[model samples]
Target chain A: MATPQLKQTPLNAAHRRMGARMVDFGGWDMPVQYPYGTIEEHLRTRTHAGLFDVSHMGEIDVRGRDAIAFVNRVTSNDASKLVDGQAQYSALTTPEGTVVDDLLVYRFAEDHLLLVVNASTTPKDWEWIRSHKQDEAVELKNMSAEYCQLALQGPDALRILQTLTDLPLSEIKYYHFREGAVDGVPSIVSRTGYTGEDGFEVYAAAERAEQLWDRILEAGRFGETDGVMPCGLAARNTLRLESAMALYGNDIDETTTLLEANLGWICKLGKGVFIGREALARQKEEGVKRRLVGFEVTERGIARDHQDVLVNGERVGQVTSGSPAPYLKKNIGLAYVPVEFAGAGQEIQIDVRGRAVGAQIVPTPFYKREKKQSAGSHQPSAKTQ
Target chain B: MANVPEDLHYSKDHEWLRVEGDVAVIGITDYAQNSLGDVVYVELPKPGEKFEAHESFGSVESVKAVSEIFTPVSGEVVEVNESLSDEPEKVNEDPYGAGWMIRMRMNNPGEVDSLLSSVEYEEFTSAETE
Candidate 1:
């Protein structure tokens, strides 16, 4: 018998009210799609705006005199270079250079930082962080259960959020954040998101989240066009896939290294030591044997996880994440392949359900955003920015 | 939910079987297609391949995941669906008629009695959540 799935987010009732199809996602009962369908929700986020209940993600607060130093030693990215109000994408890795989880580290101040980890790995990450914090004076607090995260993503995100806050939305630069109020609810509005589009991630008290969700939906109605709709996990996956954003378990796991996963950019060996710096530096200098490459199926067949990857009739690697990109209307996936076959335009084959289908290596970011205003275009007032 | 034709018999694994003299036609039930979502590919047993009861005969892949198709009874594969290679969605569109996966010469015709009738299959699937 199938075990009952775990808890729901604060917006679970609201999702049902909006006609969402709920599914068990990593043990959390979450919305997979709304009545508008995955394709419609995806296009809305790409062309206009979409709201997402991302409360399932894990959040932790690190604070102390040694917080910055503590974080710099634990994560792969060069965290010491981060300025107040800025955030950087980084990875927490095992001693062997394998990625434990990919996360965002937000520098709230010189002495305080916020780490957002994948939901499934929250418990394990918390334990790992806590164990490593032994000598440091830093206070590690798992604030995941206390806050609800909502992502307002796409082109019109700033416009929709502008109506709710007197703080200038345009002043908040990409990957930067500010404290703001949404319908009387205090929130941390950060110009960051997973969708490779301009957006804001709002962190608010869990109890106040439902009201804020309703207010955002109401605010959308006043726009010149129908504004943002609540999107679920299905469109979220497709949107991230099109952007070539890596999903935690599928694209990179504890068994996969950052270098092999094409995330060497996040590893900064020139800086002081980190958890997996030694292993990562060795892999970087020696060159990765197998590398993750993006591929588009030229023929029919949707390559999926664990499917064998063949190059010149020889099995080399396997697909890690695959899907029929709704936006591109073609089958696309990411796989680990021999470095020789990782270049763009190289021919390859994916064994889909035992049949080899033609595919081609492609550049990352299968979809790109049209040129828009610069990230610097958004800045808050001198007092609040 | 799609209707299960009264003449067909279904196994607990969701395969539907139809007896035509000594030969048996095997395909996935309508409930299986609905649950699997858009069928993108189907792998069928090769002609003349023999299998024991409960052995995996082939597999079907959808956008969401893959599931193995099992043989309900021991048999020798007589033929496989050729059109599915070009039009796999037919399994979702018409699972009973055009989506038939294979035909086999049943080694034990007596095993047919163990398959559920359309009425029993409907009841079995009605309690299942999609």
Candidate 2:
């Protein structure tokens, strides 16, 4: 069989021009890092600002009279609570209460909503959401190709972005968005980001991706002082990992339920009958057997994904996501362990490439944005893990 | 183009070997470090450890992934670069110089004749990247 061609995002040429190292990410020709490297990009996002091309992520528009009803029926979150211009992180749930794909539900109104899903799971999510459609007035349109999304993230992201558009950015609170023009390019400016920073995500037409990208970078460079670094998928992953955000395939999958993934906050199990309510509600009442827990390596080695979690040399669970957090200055990771070993301050062992290394379960949000900035940055952020 | 020093001998696995009298210095090639990206941690074999030709000696961890470094010739490790534990980025910055991983007393000095020359390794790397 012939190998399928890798799909390129609209900003592919710009990435190449910037000397980005490209890799095959889920069959998409995506930049993994720039010449400066992932560690530098990761630190740049934490300290200053970083621009990310997230055009590969899929977007599906749900329209019709039953849009609200259809969305609430198919997803795990309470869409009825989302007002106009409000967005919530949610997931397309399976009948078995597992996640088909974790997504962001942007409610334009009661009759129109846009679901942004993981790039690799876009096709699968579409088929799954469609399979659940049994005589509803809902119309699902896959609009993945027509749009390009960029996330401007960091502590100074707002100051840089404010120069681009007259969107009244500060008025757009956390998790709120507005439709406006960014540097004359039409966009949906949402104050939502994967990195746990005060940032914004812009969704614009695919044809204008390059224009919007260059303008944002320019705005970040406003005076050629606060330049926004172009980051890649590697930095994107590390930033999200530090935030303790659940990655689609790694942190949560078809076999992992919302409650088990520590995403019970998004699970409005009481909101009528949904796709996964039955199984999820049952699990809630019975209590979860295993849970997703954040941890730090107490010893020397770094614990990575798929490595075993051991207790007295006996295998228990596995690490779902792990990395050396450049900002936190320590090795951190997430894993699914038995409930007995999931609490904060609990001790566990990580099989780091066959070496049973010591680890400590810790509270999440490994790096939290400080409410106030001091004179110096000795320990400006709150690190729970 | 990757910097393949004319005097160094290379293995197909991208390790470059520099001989000094009976002692042989070994490290990854420029192409290898460039592909690895942002070295964070390096695991090196201790002095006195022995290995055969084309054997795995140590591992290098970058920000995103881990890769193994192979030894080009058989020998006992005479010295290992200890500075790498604190500063592995040297592997990416100076893979052929300060980044040299280990020094070995050669088991068979004649093995150098079978290794790829600088020009041959350059061609091999160009084809591999393509």
Candidate 3:
């Protein structure tokens, strides 16, 4: 009987030097927050910009003559619709129509693609894909160890990032990416982020991760965007929760289908045949039984994850993720219940401890960045979560 | 490292108590506040509520989690720090001073001698953290 070792990202030393409060997150030793605290770090991301070391996410490279077909067979989203330089939010669903994992697919070309999966579920996702390959024409490589990622997110992200890269970032649309050099380091710059704000995600070699992190921080110090703050996992969790994004283990899991998680938009059933297509199609036609809904605590208590949700004194569901939204100054959470009780403004109660705390279903995302303030002044792009 | 005053008695749960005659002032230790992060809300019991030793009086909510504050000795609450409702950050700023939570009329003064001394409490917290 022995305790397994926790994995550390390349930026672990940097986070320690900055006095970040470290914690074990999903078997990875990562920083939960810096001395600035989660509330301040959260607010900093909303108002200015925040730098996040998201290197723990797994990256798998899919390449070969049948890469496109293989990806199309595994993921719920249509891979054929993704042009070069485009990224799609998709789910790896089981034959039962339940989610295996939600992942981001980056299409570099017809024969080459990148799948970024959750750190905790990477091994499972990789095995599921490898076992289902139709032929040897598709090759899979686990590149998680070769790369590290950084998310520069918020209203000021573009300004901070422009100082390091010579590429025309303004032309890159949301959910799109380009192969370029950032701070003299070869990297893939994607106009994607988990925070509900405008931002870019930079993926670089693991060896160069520390240098790229330092250079990005140095360039962002005291400029037009008023600098960027180093945010940790706690802030990242709160930010994503406020945006009503689904956390794999929490909001959706093996027992929940993609449609039940309210992510049917990514499930393209009519695009030929794929794994789980028949089950998902049947579910869609039969309609979802229980729907995940966003909720705001109306009473004087903070709802917590795993707490029971009651409707008129009967248990309906349980909270998936709950937190005090710093920018919104409200306590919000997500839960799943019967479709009859899923509409916005529907009354519900979250049993915090023994007492029932008043709550109500609200339309997600709880917070949205004004379109005029984001890049290109285009309409705010919606997330699959 | 948190500041633990030498004149106060402490509980294993990280609460500090200062005795002034029959009335005892209580607040969470600095170590507790530091571990809890930014204190956003405080839920306190009514002024006349009575409690037994080690009973939970209320909870303090931080950005990360909620922790219950316990009574170190059985007593009737005489007064509560009302200002904390509007300014919960005071708990993080001065956990032993302006952030004092409640004043209670002690039912057994001898219970103070049984609580951990400041030196013992410091050693306990340091050992727990290590």
Candidate 4:
């Protein structure tokens, strides 16, 4: 039998032209890094701006008189608080309280919202949302292919992005967005990103992706932000992992809950009737079985994802994400363990390929960007979580 | 287009060996380092440890993944690269020189004849990558 070809985004050709080392990421042929390397790209995103082709991420539009209601019903976060032009990081959960997918809710208007989900979970998310509609008048449309997303992330994101649009980007607070024309193309510029740094995500028409990608790269070429690194998914993964942000299939899955993943801040238990609200609320009352914790390897080996975590020579949990953080200059990872071993400074061991390596639980967001004037909304500005 | 030096003996697992008398110096090929991407740490066996051919004697770790380093021929480790403890990037910069991983005394000198030559290794790499 022949293997099926991987899906390609609109920027596929552009990535190849730039000499990217491509990989298959969740069935999508995406660039994992360029010849410049993942470390360079990761650092550049923290110092200067890094342009990313996030077109493979899926987008679904929820429109109707009950759009906000429908979204609030399906997502764990209280979407009713989202005003026009605002966005929120939320998760769609199963009735059993495990995550279907973590997503971004963009409130376009009173009757319309855009849900940005992970690339691999798009089809599942769409079906879950439609099935939960339950006679609601919401119209759901999968717009994953209609728009291409380009993320310009770094401390200089605004300085570079301001040159392209006349819109007052400074006024748009974090988690806020504005519909404007970017390089003569209609676009939705959102002040959000997976990386911990301050950045903007541009959603543009699919046809204009190539030109817009080039134009954004060109615009970011000035003074301090010149030669913006064209980062790939590898850099993005490291960036997010350093921030202690959860990745869907890895950190939080169908078997995990918001409380277990340390995302209780987004679980609004009192938000009233939702798919997983009861289970989540009950779990909250009884306390979680285990809690996710960030750790640093005090030993020689690098702990990798799925490695077992041990406490007192007993297996407690497993690593969800792990890597040698480029900027921190240390090996770090996230793992789920019994609550007793989840505190900072707690001692633990990671079984790296059968060899026990000493590690210690530590406070996360190992790398935090100094905040600029505009503070992000939707969640408490706790630099790490 | 990874470098496969003409004088080195290559293993199917991407290790290169430079034999001198009965002692052989082993290092991962340029192709291996390039594929691994920015090796952050290397776990090497002790100098006295003995291993058979194709046995995992050490491990190489990068920011993305971890790979085991297998010995190309059966031998007793005589010396291990200690500089890599602080300068792991040497594996990426000069994989054939400062990045050489281990030195071992070959238990069976005749085993060298079984390893691939530079030309054969180059062809193998091309075919594997394709």
User: Model 1, stretches more than 4 Å misplaced?
Assistant: A1-5, A16-21, A221-227, A376-385, B1-34, B38-62, B67-119
Pitting candidate 1 against candidate 3, the one with the higher TM-score is 3
Candidate 3 residue runs with Cα over 4 Å from true position: A222-225, A373-385
Candidate 4 lDDT, A51-145, residue by residue in tens: 89999999999999989888998999999999999999889988888899999999989999999999999999989988888878889999999
In angstroms, the error of model 2 at A45 is 0.8
Best by DockQ: 2
Better of 1 and 3 by DockQ: 3
Per-residue lDDT of model 3, residues A1-385, tens digit only: 8878989999999999998988888889999998888988898899989999999999999999988888999999899998999888888999878899999999999999999999889889889988888764878999998999999998888888988998888788888899998989999999988888889999999999999889888877933446788998889989998888888898888899988888888889988778889999999999988888899999988898999999999999989998889889999999888888888899999998798999999888888877653344222222323
Residue A354, model 2: lDDT of: 72
- The candidate that wins on TM-score is 4
lDDT (10s digit) by residue, model 2, range B15-60: 9999999889999999999998888889899999999999999898
Give the CAPRI class of candidate 2. high
lDDT of 3 by residue, B61-90 (tens): 987789999999999999999999889999
Clashing pairs in 4: none
Q: Predicted chain A of model 3: TM-score relative to the true chain A?
A: 0.96
Model 4 segments more than 4 A misplaced: A222-226, A378-385
**Model 2 C-alpha lDDT per residue in residues A1-385, reported as the tens digit of each score:** 9878999999999999999999999889999999888988888888889999999999999999899899999998899999999888888898899999988899998899999999999999999888888888989999999999999999888888999899998788777799999999989999888887778999999999999999888878822434688899999988888888888899899999988898888889889999989999999999989998899999977889999998778898999999988889788999998998888998889998777999999998787777443312112111232
Tens-digit per-residue lDDT, A211-245, candidate 1: 88988877876233567878888789878888888
Worst 10 residues of 4 chain A by lDDT: A376-385
Evaluated at residue A365, the lDDT of candidate 1 is 80
